[model samples]
Target: MQHFLNSSFTIPAERNEQLESLLKIHCHVFPYPAKTKFLEYGDAMDGVYYVFQGRTKHYILAEDGAEKILYCLSSGWFFGETPLTLHEPTGLISETMEPSILWKIPYSVYDKLLDVNKLFRTAIMNCMSRKMLIMRHEIENQVFNPCKQRILQLLCSTVDNASLVEGKWYNLSSHYTQYEISTIIGSARVTTSKLINELCNEGFIRILNRKLQVSKIIYEEITDQMDLL
Candidate 1:
């Protein structure tokens, strides 16, 4: 598979706008505050969702009840297709990370669009393809890479979603706690802390006011090394 360490896998803006316009007529738009757990494991999948104005985390609970983040969705991204298409209950928990607007298109509407709208069909297929690639990359990282490398890879993968601060350092757009970072990297909190400090000392990354930032040079270096690997 192609390298995906730095891929955000977001849909292109033009196609995203087209899809949004098409769904607007049939969707129920809702405003949600940060930390809204709108969908949970085993909930009936009544519709597909599109992010109009916020970020969300999609994850599953481990046997020990720990949350393992599968991926994050930003504005323009769509989700809930798998369970909806399969006529099964939701298998992942989806929660908003910030105050946002979302569109919920009923299953009947979604099905009709898939059958009648070529653009809609193509966009959904592309979304599924990208999701599969991301999952494959995550699995390979977990099985083949060390914890520290995995952590770096995660940071690299999020660069597109981060913002540049003072025109020099890229600040992670989302505020992630050490515990959350541990869960994402599949490591213990204490171990994650130590490794984060190690990365800081080596100039790979730094934390300011509890927000992680990486310099452009360091970001490029990490991506380069990842490419070689």
Candidate 2:
């Protein structure tokens, strides 16, 4: 499989030395299969993780056993910070969405790197702030956005913006089922299904096989509607 990080994203050069340092210490490459749980809710975290390939989901299990996805992350995204920072059990479950490769940096080495690497510290701080902002946006979308708008935003989030065909298509459905999409957007299954159909009818989105193809025109329309809201 192509490395998503190499295709459309590159790690910032400033953090290369820090990454190298971890490589020399406790960091090691690990592979995980789809649906494999790296950390369960309340499980103790042993380290921090960096995704080098494929996708993963950070979620919570509801009382009913349903997974409520908080974030779907691909290459360059890091995890295990909440537990590492608190020195406690993980609050959310982290699982693979696809066959994935990750670099695990044991907590002891993680602390050493943070103490000596200003650039790494800055990058991690920025990542944490971004994660918080994304959480806020997710909550706001669920509370205030219509199902159609919510779905549009969710689909757009998966776009490979650095690719040549970036805005023209998104392979979102390949990564998530309709039910999972509904859960992420906080919509009922019926509502999500109906809005998906409406989007297709309105020429706002098209699904070939499971890939969601999004046109620039539809993207502009979604943006305009969001602006109005």
Candidate 3:
């Protein structure tokens, strides 16, 4: 249900209710210690997860003081697959949002189970494809878009395609700092802050509660890019 909440399109209520029941069929539902920085990029994770309760943020850091937020996961989403299939590392910095509960399983064990139940392999392949596509989209957004526009676009996109009513506003939940945004957007802190003020003056976005709040114009600009998409 939460995954679909950030989706580009609507989903049926019944399907939302069914996610939990279906998740139990594949992974171990157990509490995991908080602050666990699990598998990283290029390394392997033995299995994927359907986070039953918890939050994790996926981010990549560059030595030059750049940080790109790749994606975030919460309950009802699955992550960590390379260890399970290719027997490789996850190769990303994954941090838990709190004391968490997750449905996890081992890939090697899954392979053994799949030797008899071939259908599981097919399911894994499909899930992997979707996750890869999402990663690609995140890279594309940061690579080409301007920081202020990109931030507005991302917030609006995550809010599920609805236009912000004129004057409607709220702060970013993550409290993502300007330094962090600069790192993620591949810009310097000064440049990012300048762009942000420009956005505010132009009536496209603003800082409220020390967080970014976008206007309908910002939303329009984002959709304009997709008009080309």
TM-score of each: 0.89, 0.82, 0.67
What are the clashing pairs of model 2?
Answer: none
- The predicted structure with the larger lDDT, 1 or 2, is 1
**CA shift at 210, candidate 2, in angstroms?**
2.2
Q: Which ten residues in a row have the lowest lDDT in candidate 3?
A: 6-15
Per-residue error for 193 in candidate 1, Å, reads 1.0
Tens digits of per-residue lDDT, candidate 2, 1-229, equal 1111211111222335555554546678989998898888788888888777778888887797776778777776677876798899989888888999988888887788789988667666876766776777666776876777677666665554444254465443334678888778777788888888888888767877765666666665655665565
Better of 2 and 3 by lDDT: 2
Off by over 4 Å in 1: 1-15, 160-168, 173-175, 227-229
What candidate 3 gets wrong by more than 4 Å, as runs, is: 1-19, 29-36, 40-44, 63-65, 112-123, 160-167, 170-175, 217-229
- lDDT over C-alpha atoms for residue 8 of model 2: 17
Listed per candidate, the RMSD to the true structure in angstroms reads 2.6, 5.7, 5.4
TM-score of structure candidate 2: 0.82
Per-residue lDDT over 1-229 for candidate 3, one digit per residue giving the tens place of the 0 to 100 score:
2221222111111123444544466667667676686656565565776566766666777776356656666655556765556566666787675678877766655666557654455555655665666556556655765566555554555442343444465443344567656654557789878887887888776776676766655555656665665
Model 2 spans with C-alpha error above 4 angstroms: 1-25, 161-174, 224-229
**lDDT tens digits, residue span 55-106, model 1:** 8888889888888888878787789999899999988998987898999999
Please tell me which predicted candidate would have the highest lDDT against the true structure: 1
Of candidates 3 and 1, the better by lDDT: 1
